[model samples]
Target: MKRLLPLLAVFAPAPAFAHAFLKSAEPSVGAVVATPPAQLLLTYTEGLEVPFCTVTVAGPDGAQVQTAKPQPVPGHENELAVPMHITAPGKYVVTWHALSQDTHKTQGSFSFTVSP
Candidate 1:
């Protein structure tokens, strides 16, 4: 029983190491929209450290599109948003790096099309 108790203590904090993952997005992954979205919003499974996170948008031509730095959505620590200007109609790739409040880091990318 003494050995079992020590083992349990070591695993008890495993959940605290959980990494944040993309929960959803505004234009959503693989979405085809008729009009260009004015902003990109990303939601994560856990609260993020906005100052240590980043989100980037690549335009249809593969150039980095101009966008405001990602900001935490007001009143929502797990949600981040960036205002973007998109004029062309094509696929845009969004890549993000997230640092969770607990300090775990994660990253992912997805593309969406603007048909307008």
Candidate 2:
């Protein structure tokens, strides 16, 4: 039994290192602004696969804005940028989903407001 215990420990599954998270943003979370930002930027903790990752923006009325597709920033695997065209807004939510190099997927969201 003692010899078998040692073998079992060796075969035990290790904990998975989860995909990266949103470390920060440009306008910042829950920020209120007088005018809309020309571009939105998101920074993550680890590199993300561009093909399987996406960032979306929704207006205060829960309607999605026709924003530009997310693009990877130069020399930074953990940063992404998206263009914006916000007309009228009260609260805007930014949602993101990303897949890591290990094929694990993760998602999260944040919101900010545009003052009238």
Candidate 3:
């Protein structure tokens, strides 16, 4: 039993060092909205280090559309928002990199559309 206990401990999950994975978004992944969104909101599976995280939005033409850097949502430690200035009707790609409070890093990208 003692030998097995050590082995189990070695294989146990490390919840304290988990990455901050994307849990949801405002416009949502692959959503089609009639109007452009004023901002992009992202929720993560864990709290983020706001200063070490970044979210970027690019228009269909490949130009950057986000007006500013990502900021943490008030009172929400696991959420971040990016102000947007998009007008054209097309697909927009949002990419994000997160550094969790425990120092684990994660990143991913998704796209949404603005219909004319």
Output the number of the TM-score-best candidate: 3
TM-score of each: 0.85, 0.79, 0.86
Ranking by lDDT: 3, 1, 2
lDDT of each: 0.90, 0.84, 0.94
Runs of candidate 1 exceeding 4 Å displacement: 1-13
What would the per-residue lDDT of candidate 2 be over residues 23-102, giving only the tens digit for each residue? 89977889998888888888887888877888899997888773778888999988888888889968989998988766
Span of 10 residues, lowest total lDDT, candidate 3: 12-21
Runs in model 2 with CA error above 4 Å?
Answer: 1-18
How do the candidates rank by TM-score, highest first?
A: 3, 1, 2
- RMSD in Å for all candidates: 3.6, 5.1, 4.1
- How accurate locally is residue 111 in candidate 3, as Cα lDDT from 0 to 100? 99
**Candidate 1 Cα lDDT to native:** 0.90
lDDT of 3 by residue, 15-116 (tens): 864789999999999999998999999999999999999889999999999998998888999999999999799999999999999899999999999998
Error of 3 at 95 (Å): 0.8
